[model samples]
Structure formats: C-alpha cells, structure tokens
Target: ERHRDMRRASSSLLGLAPRLLSGPRLCSRPLPLLAFARASQQRSGDAALALGEIRVADATGSLGVMTPKQALALAAERKLHLVEVAPNASPPVWKLLATLPVVEKRPEPPKIEEM
Candidate 1:
C-alpha cells in the first residue's frame, strides 16, 4: 500500500539506503578503544651503573673504565653522585652530579627589649 511505503520512506533519511539502517549499527555505537583513565604511565628511573665495570667521564672529558663500586666511592669521596649520562655508546659514560642541599626554616630569634 502507498501508506506502508510512505511510512518506510519517512523512517529513513533522504538518499540514505534503508539497508544501512536495518544492518548492524556501527556509527551509533562507540568503538573498541581503551581509555587510560586509571592507568599509570610513569616509570621509575633505573640506574645502569651497577657493580659491573663502566666508562666514566672525568673533568677533562676523558673516558675511563672502572668498577661501579670504585666510581661510587670516588664520587662519595668528592661528595657527589655518579650518574650515567650516555647509555647507548660503545661504553656507557658516567658523570658526577652534586645533590642539592635541603633548606629548612629556622625559628625567629627571640625579641630583646633594650632600655
């Protein structure tokens, strides 16, 4: 009937095929994408310098291979931290880094009244 045909035609948008609506819905539904709402993306720093031998960079920009314990001891004697700078080189290079001193707030001096 013409009424049935008009109802079918009115249900679908103009120029859009009726088969598209009757088929499985894809655009109306969300895709299978994951949301990292509760996920943690941060990673802790891992020191490549261990007990094994590694190349260290001195003040003169020269490289020398030494055990991590020796380098660490040398850094400790100098009051510094041995940090690995180059990890992709033929031999990893280490550099000495100075740690910042923590500053604390001190109580104000007692007020003195002079006559």
Candidate 2:
C-alpha cells in the first residue's frame, strides 16, 4: 500500500515534463549586436579634437594656436581629418591628415645585460 502511493506520486510529477531539472534551452529571439554600441556612441561624440583650446599642425608640422572650431575648418578645407596626436601637451596637439596614423613597431633593446 505504501509503495503503490509513492509510485502514483512519482508518475504524476513526471507528467509535468518541465525543463527545470533538464539541460539548456534556447531563447525565442536573438539579442542585437550593436545595442550597447548605439547607446554609448551618442555620448562621446567624435574621437578627434572635440573640446577645449587645441594646438593644430599642418603637413609641414608648423604649430599654431587656435580654437577647436578654427582647427576643424582648416581640416575641412583640405579634405582631411583633425586627429589628436598628443593630448598631454600644454594645449593638445592635433594634425591634419586624410586618415588615422599608422602605429610603427619599436625595436627591442639589447640582451647583453641579462643573466
């Protein structure tokens, strides 16, 4: 009598067929890839000269003082971009170029002093 009651309860629970104790399950819809990117992009604006007084340099590397707007106008006149090369200077240094600068690889130091 006791064993038969336990069998009935076990069969009733198996009929539920829920995946709580089972393996993984897939979602109904996939998540967007650029959801966070689109949200944060509007906050930072452009990566180039976007704020404060900036020091600009032309192709010849001649430095000059100007507001950010003036620097941008000069960049637009030459169909180039105003990229910030050095941001830690007294007033940040910017350059006019068609595109971003390429980073060159540095050579390794000598190993003579090593043990």
lDDT (CA) for every model shown? 0.57, 0.60
Tens-place lDDT per residue, model 2, 20-58, is 323243462223333222323221114544567878887
Worst 10 residues of 2 by lDDT: 36-45
The global Cα lDDT (0 to 1) of model 1 is 0.57
Scored by TM-score, the top model is 2
Model 1 per-residue lDDT at 110:
97
Those runs of model 2 whose alpha carbons end farther than 4 Å from true positions after fitting are 1-50, 102-115
Candidate 2: Cα lDDT at 27: 65
Q: Model 2, residue 13: what's the lDDT?
A: 77
Off by over 4 Å in 1: 1-51, 100-115
